[model samples]
Target chain A: MNITLKQAEKIIAVAKEKSIEIDTKMNIAVVDAGANLVAFARMDGAWLGSLDISIKKAKTARYFDMNTGIIGELSQPGGPLFNIEHSNNGLITFPGGVPIKNAAGEIIGAIGVSGSSVENDHTVAEAGALAI
Target chain B: MNITLKQAEKIIAVAKEKSIEIDTKMNIAVVDAGANLVAFARMDGAWLGSLDISIKKAKTARYFDMNTGIIGELSQPGGPLFNIEHSNNGLITFPGGVPIKNAAGEIIGAIGVSGSSVENDHTVAEAGALAI
Candidate 1:
């Protein structure tokens, strides 16, 4: 199942409500199960940094069907195949990223965000997920 | 502050405790403030797909000062500057990525992961962070 446009909308709405006075800029990304782009957005005044990150998070979610944070640890030395972390396109492995799941508990897609405090970033994404 | 070798080691330890019998291979990435690679590792049997994504997520965390998940949302259309989502490095924009924060709450670096399920990836990363 693919992420519906409605779900995306709810995410946005929640973000708006949760946004703080930091006037933080954000980069958001949505991808399908195949790890392909479905929709993307960047807030005004958002940093140029989000460009690469948002996409990576979506790809991680799609490819692994898990959050990037967990992937980050397993990629470490003596963890598993630590060498593989640097082997490819150089995706990230950290927290502040989550997957988008449907009612059936199957991960249909994912969403990632950046450009604020880590706590705030997680809060916004969490809000989006809770909204959905 | 850069992520020390010891911190990377801790992240790996937490992952080992959290990993399940899914035999999930993981790709982990660590980066400094400039978004340059500090350390990278990929577990054996890990999917080849993580190479690019792990790097991108690190860059995202470094550049955005937040997590990849938050950046994902701002990349959407009608959100802010969605067009920029596709620009530069073709990085990902989704969850499963996070920034590494020091005790002062300042973002010193970041970590990103891929492979296995999204939840598992997040769990492992979270475990790493908590361990630190």
Candidate 2:
């Protein structure tokens, strides 16, 4: 299964809406099932560095098929997947990434949110992933 | 040690067919084991930004002898391969790049596709790689 350009745009729209509702500017990114970037948006005044992080977060979630927060936990020093962030160019193991699924309960893509606290980032990403 | 233009074209032809089958425009590139370009094709209305990405993806696949997606999973921040992309200009660790093999299962080259969803890109590239 995969995501379409229209679907990617919808994900971004919902994510942007969530960021506005929270009063936090954000960098949002969506990647299709293969973990390649499909769409991205950087809100005005958003942290520039976060633009890359947002995209990486989206890719990471799709690569592992799990939340980045859980990856963060598993990647802790001495943990099972420790040093995992060292793979895949660079992965964001913290919160803010969520998988997007289709009506068939199949993962179609993922959304990543940044430019705010990890909690806020996760919240925004969740909002976007639910759009479909 | 390398791929011929004829073979590269054949690969691209198959890839293009798959791309058309999936209804996605794509920029496709084929590279020999030396990480050198052998052939390329840009589907009508493919993403211009992905032109460079498609080439780099082919080179990255050849250099690593594995799907870029797998390399991505191993190169996160704390993973053993963190910063691997820094070598050889920059590697595209995401999907859509696949290694080509000959009848003896020997690595010959790689194919990369960009445009539409990563799922479609990879599907097209895989079809191309299998042609050889």
Best candidate according to DockQ? 1
Regions of model 2 farther than 4 Å from truth: B1-132
Please write out the lDDT profile of model 1 over residues B1-132, one tens digit for every residue: 677877766765566556544456777777766677777777764654765666676676677877665665665555574534354565555554677777887777777776655566666655655566
> TM-score (chain A) of candidate 2?
0.98
lDDT per residue as tens, model 2, A38-59: 6666665577678778988998
State each candidate's chain A TM-score. 0.82, 0.98
TM-score of 1: 0.49
Model 1, residue B9: displacement in angstroms? 38
Q: Residue B32 deviation, candidate 1, in Å?
A: 37
Candidate 1 at residue B44, lDDT? 64
Residue A128, model 2: Cα distance from true site in angstroms: 0.2
Over the full model, what C-alpha lDDT does candidate 1 score relative to the true structure?
0.65
Candidate 1's displacement at residue B18, Å, is 23
